[model samples]
Target: MNGPGGYFGGCLTALDDCLRGTFGYTAPATLLWRDASTAREHLSRALTAEGRPYDLFAGTLQVLAEGGMHVTLA
Candidate 1:
């Protein structure tokens, strides 16, 4: 995790930047997401800027995968 006000980004573009080592960590990383199911349930109800329904959990997983990161949901 980032330290001292470090931000991992709130949107996909920022997440991509962080995954690229722009924020410090690089890709091909492993993420162990505890209570991911609960988080997913909440995040999946999010909406986009256009007021369209979006599956943030799935989207995040896709982005992480695209960045070569292995995600383990617990």
Candidate 2:
């Protein structure tokens, strides 16, 4: 939650509010903010030597999350 609402006032609550309003249900959602720059740096030097752009990966995940199968990020 932002400002004075603490955890209850932030994005998760916002999501819950939205879902409750739109679908007549409220549920928790896991939020994952991956450290992509660090990931890319390590990936470039170690594993693949080439890594997919952060946006591509994030967008794919976004699509899956919005697919309405009750998937939650971790």
Candidate 3:
């Protein structure tokens, strides 16, 4: 999988940056997957709290999925 740092990798980096800025930390990809709902919830809350549109994150996830990324939420 093309991870953060490449052309197709910025999504994870973006997520990490967002999370770090909002929650003071970053989560491992595996852990994020393991607790997908909680992760999304935190992201949603943070984005809303910060006055950013939550659709940005949702759109990124959609793009990732369309790009063949396997992100199991359950």
Candidate 4:
């Protein structure tokens, strides 16, 4: 997996490579990404508003896929 190679390749493979190298996944993880640029503008300015300088996510999702459990949200 991770294919032992280049960029943005084999998502599941990367996870497999991670599990193999680490010997196992000690904790559950969620793997996701966005190429979106400036997309956050539509949301409340409060996210960056405080100058608190941190990221906040306000909801949740429960997903069962590929015999694995995943929870996804902002």
Best-to-worst lDDT order: 1, 3, 2, 4
TM-score of each: 0.82, 0.22, 0.41, 0.23
Off by over 4 Å in 3: 1-32, 46-50
CA error at residue 56 for candidate 4, angstroms: 26
Q: What value of lDDT does candidate 4 attain over all alpha carbons?
A: 0.34
In lDDT terms, how accurate is model 1?
0.82
Can you write out model 2's per-residue Cα lDDT over 1-74, one digit (the tens) per residue?
Answer: 23222333223335445444554433445445357566444534432227533443443344435533244333
Supply the TM-score for candidate 4. Answer: 0.23
Q: Which ten residues in a row have the lowest lDDT in candidate 2?
A: 1-10
Clashes (candidate 1): 0
Most TM-score-accurate candidate: 1
Please provide, for model 4 over 27-59, each residue's C-alpha lDDT reduced to its tens digit, 9 standing for 90 to 100. Answer: 354545242223243322334445754222211
RMSD of each: 2.6, 11.6, 9.9, 12.8
Off by over 4 Å in 2: 1-54, 69-74
Cα lDDT tens digits, model 1, 1-74, are 33343777768888877777666676667888889989898999999999999999999999889988899999
Worst 10 residues of 4 by lDDT: 55-64
Better of 2 and 3 by lDDT: 3
Residue lDDT tens for model 3, 25-56: 32333222556677577665445446776654
lDDT of 1 at 25: 70
In model 2, which residue pairs have backbone atoms overlapping below 3 Å? 1-9, 1-10
